[model samples]
Target: METRKSYFFVGVGGSGMMPLAMILAGRGDQVAGSDRALDSGALPAKFADLTAKSVALFPQDGSGISSADQIVVASAAVEATVPDIVAAEAVGAARLSRAELLSQLFNAGVLPIGVAGTSGKSTVTGMIGWILHACGRDPTVMNGAVMKNFVAPQAPFASALVGQGEAFVSEVDESDGSIALYHPKIAVLNNVSLDHKSLEELRALFGTFAGRAVTTVVNVGDAESAALAMSLPRDRLVTFAIDASADLRAENLLPEPFAIGFDLVKGGERHKVRLSVPGRHNVSNALAALGAVRAAGVPLAEAITAIAGFVGLKRRFELVGEAGGVAVIDDFGHNPDKIAATLETLHAFPGRLLVLFQPHGYGPLKVMRRELVAMFAERLAAGDVLVLPDPVYQGGTVNREVTSADIVAEIAATGAQAAHIADRAGAAAHLVALARPGDRIVVMGARDDTLSLLAGDMLGQLS
Candidate 1:
């Protein structure tokens, strides 16, 4: 009864774009895309997964944009000079930003849940999606990271789940100021911090996002989010916290190497929850998910039970393997807050951390270089080692003023063991060489999926 549409994604290999393509293709839409990564054959596995879904893939030289009826969806980062954009313009094809298309689909849902934050967006989105799916709600979930719980042979990259249900759960990005576009019935704000934008801009964007929702789930442990929660009507706010008292609270914390357990308290009821993922940060993430689903009419007890089954997202403190008493972990700790949380969680145990952090981009290094240096200087133990690689730049015209060497120099001045190796492979080799028995080698960064492969290679070398 519905007419199928055609969409051509410019950067189809992107974390955000890939999932949207999958969701569209799964829904019986004609989906095709082009990516520089595909043409270069960098991530063959990712492109193969797309092809397995019957989604056509092409090189980035504008060969995919065939007709005027096709909608060209691209991220804000796509410059007008891109071949896809040039082809689309020449063909008179309709164009939409990734956020515009996602919001268009999200806003049409009967019950839309938009999860927004500086960090933990993917984890919380995956949690809410898993809980709904486990509880048989059949939610349509869109995430930037692949959910381990949803991964199957056919759906190798199960970041987006297209379901025939009313509830649609998606993580809304605030980096490009697109969080304002989504109209969510239930909004979840995990925490507010300086990531892609300044605190002032983030505050205004996040405040309006939460205020528009019929019910809002907020983390009171974060000062900025707590302040925003106070500004919203109390009746519509559902608060969660680990250190601070709130409507949904996680107490009696227990941290382990591969898992964490805590007692979740809501009203007069309390229940123990154990997640396969490690860290106090994940406990906070779980509370946010519980609060969100609870606001969506899922019972507290049911949400807790379903959340306990959550494994976690790939690259979110994922342990690749343990060999010769050394563990290699892959994490998506790009920003200051995310890196701090990863450092804190890793520091909770007794092993020395050999952290190889690749900055996500030169632009972010310009913004948070000082904070990153400060976090590393404060968080790294006396014997711990930190290695830095030049940020990931995928052929873009960006200011390279703030290099990783500057960050390492600043951190070294604070008496921390820091080194900058312009090459990521050299950085990883350095970390591996510094790794000792009982030490955990963490490959941390974002915007690059090869970090996981690097972690695997480190594990292989260790073995």
Candidate 2:
């Protein structure tokens, strides 16, 4: 279906919803959105970032949904009791799931590329966006995280690029099973792992999404990704890997958080690419993007140039500030794999490490508590410290048994430094007081954007 000339978003401040609203508004749609946070007179700073664009924000009350002609779009979190939903229903406005509306735009374009996986979707989106822009293709990129490269004075991050070129790249979501909606011209599968959903559910959704594409780019290093790639039509699959044989493989890779750079060996050709981001996981993210770009018909040499100029995304290993000889790092690492990756990277540098991790949700911890404890115990050295705050979501219906204390106890059982702070403010203050000079303080979590802000506040205390 073609996009309507006007749109109304139900939760505009969301990481996923904000960029999408900006993209549609950039396409010249009459766009407005409402959020409960705005209605209750509490607006997070993240929402303020959208003020630079032409889009309008309203309270979650029916005020934002006045017209029947305009399409209503909502994220998975939006409920039927919302005033906008009620208004749309009363006025006979068409309510579209965020994925439905997003997939429509993606399919409408002449060139549609999807980056999907449990992790690295946002990073891959940034990588591919940079590659296309550097090749002078000027592709439109829609991502969950803010791309540092696209930041302007007014719009510090996030963009809805209505480029002259036909290519459009986006990171697809699977948390609510929305990944099924997208059918890309080129599909990139990073790695399949447990997070918000089960692997079986992830596999089916990602497999179906990739199979519908004209060309599917996949990671051969991962078993689930490799299995998904093998199921696709051979002619349609372009494989990439840091290991195993494939169309593109990253060889001689070295990740440094301080330098944020790596060297890649592709097809007997060795070229070092500098990434302004930390961790080995990001190197893998770059390879996934490179694979998708090649599958989309970009030349090998030009792909190198695009990535070299690419800066990292916001809140994913983001370096907020340094003061009092302490460097504060903010990352969206909530899952086992991501936590392990972050800890492993920081260990490479010569400094004591301290983690202020707020688990994203109670449900995710219940699913992966064992893995979480095991990974942290294995990676963290004797001097490293880990602080935990209660899981971020408290206002909803969920299993009550799972808590940060449970995960903390498990990690502590393995002889690692771990603590559970009942309050966010106390946790931030404790980290500041405990931090020694030259210690790397990393604030890690998901679902809540406040973690980044808290990291900044911690930096202020250290300063």
Candidate 3:
């Protein structure tokens, strides 16, 4: 746990591992690691940024660990048979999961703000970080996605920011059940739904997370979140909502294609707030950010002003390009709730959608097969087109009983134009042929880093 010790990450290039690596390296730790992606030379720009910041890059061939004094960090997905894990075991180095290491750093002499939920964890974390940074708090932020406000020429991958302040803001994941590791000063629970686990299991994990925080920022609009808030002491709970009454609420809501304007009402004082990110879900996210910063002793008006300038995180309804009157958007929405929220935002505007959705993995597709079909069937319009490519393969043995074709078949039954293309290239070609001047082509998925690149390439073809 010493800042000056040597640390090696097993999957260093992953979204979760990269930011932690950068933060450790920035704090004068000797950070080095490797990934399967590194061996294949994928995401060159991200690896280059890490190397520039003094993080040693290595292949996944077990050469990164040479001594027993170095601590080896591995993500939850890293298997015991992996070379990095084996090497660390052979060298007698201390091994820690990514969440364990992050919890250690977060709990060390800093005011920790943990954002936990099934969705919108990264966005809320970024919003809180931006508000604190803009108000001169100089907070260090560790996020899973690149915050556009912190992106600079030298730091294209702005996932983590090392600042000289007392606050440490991070998004905690519940999928792997690591959210219980940290006792945060302020905990923000966005919502509870089915994503990585069953509903009952998620409730228990999130309830414990909310119970440990000094101040719990609960979204009252979500029923499960509201239920958790009711169990906490009155003084320890700070609530925000868009529908029901709460400590912070958004009234007179207005939703546009890429922006939303609303009145934030707190303590009978109304402040007009506008966000650059689209969707009603983002309005809920904004309220959670407001309550979090308020609990951290930031004035409500100052936090509201900073929220307006927040430019949102990458791949969260990111507009890649507009060519020939056709716009292509890149989004990281894989689960049913996330996908439904994105579709609702797009439908609010007046454009035919050409959706190309790739399932993140086979396991999730099988778990949420019925819900996925029902979502696409009910949400998609008559003239809209839904195209699906096979789930991104990451070298795993999975049951292939439920596939993309099943979802497509269900959607087509509901009178929507849907197709399942086997590869991304074929899906892109089909989208190019079907795209018209007034249509918006949305490329959506999760877990895969190349989806953003594919979105840009789709734009090029339209032009």
Candidate 4:
């Protein structure tokens, strides 16, 4: 398998797929792929970077799969109907799911560290990667989001780092049951909640994930993760928490406008650690990182100090720009839990929020409509406004009964100011008109890459 030289990715522009493609290319593999966004020129910068790394780009047509020896890698979202799949079959190319390829690379020789959770997986994975790098571990890290610390002039899209060391760190997803494919030396479960699947399904997936690890690190503050800890042997399980007793505990919490400080306690030693990234949730993520790094044999104090220099991942409450004294923020907060966390962090500061939220997809919106409505109603202050565009449509038939209008109505009934604008352009206009000097205009959603561009446009208009 190490002699395999060529890889063709189906959705090369996707957040998850991009990092893997880059990693393989960095390792001197012949990487080539296609995506709808690439063909439409939606992400020219990303495509250009990939091309510079010697990874060829192609349209979704069958031309990319040239030889029978080339491996075709595709995400679970890519159906068999895609032209790339047809081409691969025609060429007799070996096919593999994205997760299958990742697991094969992860389980090979390297000491794999897998971060898994309903949320915070990307952030925690980036943090662990950064810590390991800072400690001179020279680990190869694959994350879904761009890690700002690793960004360089040549590598603007710094989502993956290819290192010649014994450590390999990556975030494993449980959404499509891919978490079962990984066998990590140290597995970190940040938190467990309802997002992609039912609670029962998540429990089984996450439980198996933790059980397979050599040393499992869990969050005691999260009810589900904490419950899973009970099944693991004490010698094999490590626990971290903010409010509950655990092997690693964070206390003396201090939350600033865009940063947070906390005291990390482990093994009767307390280290004062501060993060440039804001929110109490991040502190929990930091604790999880610390636990995982410590499990990997890094000294507690060294790992804590390395974490102090950690720059957070993009789109996790990323500040786009401040124009006319109004700040425009872009966030990947589509699910109810993630949305609530972002809102809570923003509310900790003084400014009123003018939130323009696009539901990630029609199906997720329908699945979590009531929870989403309740989150908006409970979190938004009286003067704060919540605007909604239609759920992001990606060419699938879904139940349209629980639309953005339904969510807005439910939120408005709870005495919060809310409106549904049908589309992003109208929502942007409404948000611009309502913006004030001290207000924050937050463009929040997921799945759609255009949300960041939309946020930038809003900032320009405000200016």
Candidate 5:
């Protein structure tokens, strides 16, 4: 009898790797992996979905990799010192980075739509996957977030969706320059901005991504994306924007705190669309999703109809429960631009905005500390609150000088109510204690997925 292929993911509970693991396991492969997060049960969420599927989760150990045929999957965060790497090497198993594995595996499939941008990549990826699934495309998506639209009470965070169709969709990350790896048949790049690298670096990576794909979806409101669109070959580009003149344009817009309702114009016809997901940025996300679906050969009308029902991903403006009439929201907005956008969206709603913004890492704070301070100063309304927990670091090189107190002092200079709580759990308690009816308490952070858990705990406490 032929030996079954064994797949072992080193950091299996990771947001990216978990979905990928689920997809492989759904394909009848012998999928098992190890994660310190799961071993310690520090993240019950990280392994919950896989466990429901009967995908065994093991501790980080050499025992998990006893054969040379085992295919090892790792993320950028996985270190050389991980026991699984040692085990895989001892058995001569093929080691692959999550990006390398995804790029190779995803590119081999049909209708791989790669969504890339400095921001909104994950959102657009989920949006495209949602629209496709709603329109009966049965898209198999690999995302970095738990898409709330796919989640059930049973499967609260359905990250990877196993579908019958050939469309294998995923968000492409340019932070590690892994965007170059996959040649998707359809590519949607929301916008180019400085996040991890310089503008020149972003342009080069995004520019190459546009050129390599069979058809590229570019956002024109952002000049960097426009420049990329201008560079694309005649048969390879489609443009979308809310305020810009493009093939896919959202017109007659009414932006609400709960949803942005607009008419999407495509192929000279206007189709009414309403996005349940809040934010003006989601308008751009919607445009990107529609553009990619069009590239996927879905009818403009069908895609628009399907897109109206997307509820958004978890922690992307997730409403954790209204306790004592105070609305607590959890959002993944670590970067300066994302933080600014989320605040701006929440500010539009009729309520007092209290933002508990946590930095995901010390390195990010050091790199973006100034911009983060400036953003809070600029967008925070009067009566708005800003809370900071120290940046989260999991054994990485980070500047010691950067701290939450540093940001608190800077935001205070702008006359905004900012404070550094130092501890996330304490920060949550502080926010909840201050909560009142008619106020929106937003917990914002990234990298450490536990922020969502913290948000839930805050909500549970409040209720």
Candidate 6:
């Protein structure tokens, strides 16, 4: 019998941390955690959800660690100087990185599916989880974002679903090289691109990840992922793409304002796939999910049928509401690829974009500064407006070399209407003021969940 363990997470409110905490608490483990966000009183609903699950929440001031038997889990971003960490050290509690603990839990599953990529991992994980559940697999799914399909009145934040079945589905992160920690029965590679790591580093990490899996599901539509797929053993690989020949192919693509339709072709059999989520990127995500569940032994047709009901994650191009002929959207598009995809999806329609993008953090801004500027400069249409605030800073010290102002200036050099507001609310106010009829106001960022509230506020004001 597995003994119940007591665990405390230092950054419990984080996108990655929250789901793991939920999974642990769901399994009858003693779970407690603290977050900088909780201290600042941000995103109360999330904390409330955790509290409702019997997971204790605390201030980041080290009060949560009362016993030495408690295991402290912290993300890589948490410094040793954090009050929680300092407290845990003083209490002689064992410590583990979030990835270390998640990998341990995930690897222990009878069947583990690790979804990896620069983008769409969360969406694809949600799709596969939904499909597996619909097919009666009853998978335990861990994701970074809330799966709308799983959201219930009692469970508003449905990022983690605990089940008794053998299958464990989770999106694995490569940002901290933690993708290497998970050994999955089914590894789904949505795409390999420059996000947190270099292309070279990404290729190596993704290659080894694919190599370790019993069956690798890859997207041939992405150049980097396609190259990775080509290198893997053919017998262990299942590939998918958009408008190209692969094990699973999506053709006859059609984009709607809030949904998409595609023809999924697998093994010379054709089936129409309609996703409640919009964008070509999601079609690729659907293909990757189909490939993954298919590799997991689910019938492709049944998987396709289940996937059509996927409503997508909460912040991935989520339409907040339309008011006074202006549509407001909330999205988690921090990286260049994700931002570009959102821009492309919105541009497919007729509205001019009024974008307010908050960089997730200073570190990512420094890493992808050039690519971000280039993406915004090229993707923002002539009439579109872009606003940015300073990157999210919870507490830790970071290099301030790359600021939002720098990005805005570089993008403005290309004649795009860009501004740096330095405050999120001010930036959002600017976007709301600039938004007009026949325009779409988009709030894009990550790490911080308050952006959704900002979008809703904008919608209310527009009304």
Q: Rate the local accuracy (lDDT) of all candidates.
A: 0.91, 0.82, 0.91, 0.89, 0.84, 0.92
lDDT of 5 by residue, 354-419 (tens): 788878777667767777888889988898888898878777455678788988998899899988
Clashing pairs in 2: none
lDDT score, candidate 2, position 82 = 68
How many pairs of residues in model 3 come into backbone collision?
Answer: 0
TM-scores for every candidate against the unseen true structure:
0.98, 0.94, 0.98, 0.97, 0.95, 0.98
lDDT of 4 by residue, 134-206 (tens): 9999999999999999999998989999998888999999978999999999999998887778889999999
Which model, 1 or 2, shows the larger TM-score?
1
Q: Write model 2 residue lDDT over 1-463, tens digit each, in one string.
A: 3444788888787777888888877776778888766666554555676655777888778887777888899875666776788999999998888889888888887889998988898889988998898888988889888888887777765645556687999999888898888888898888898887888888899899999999888888888999888788899888877755887776665666554565566667877777767777787888888878887789877887778788888887888989989999999888888888888888887999988998888888888877888888898888988999888772546785889998899899889999999898898899899998889999999877667779988999988
Q: State the TM-score for model 2.
A: 0.94
User: In model 3, which regions exceed 4 Å deviation?
Assistant: none
True-structure RMSD, every candidate: 1.1, 2.0, 1.2, 1.4, 2.1, 1.1
Q: Among all windows of ten consecutive residues in candidate 1, which has the lowest summed lDDT?
A: 1-10
Model 2 segments more than 4 A misplaced: 1-4, 40-49, 260-263
What's model 5's lDDT at 367? 69
Better of 5 and 6 by lDDT: 6
Q: lDDT score of model 5?
A: 0.84
The TM-score that candidate 3 achieves is 0.98
Which regions of candidate 6 deviate over 4 angstroms? Answer: none
Show model 5 residue runs off by greater than 4 Å.
Answer: 1-4
Name the better of 4 and 5 by TM-score. Answer: 4
Question: Comparing 3 and 5 by lDDT, which wins?
Answer: 3
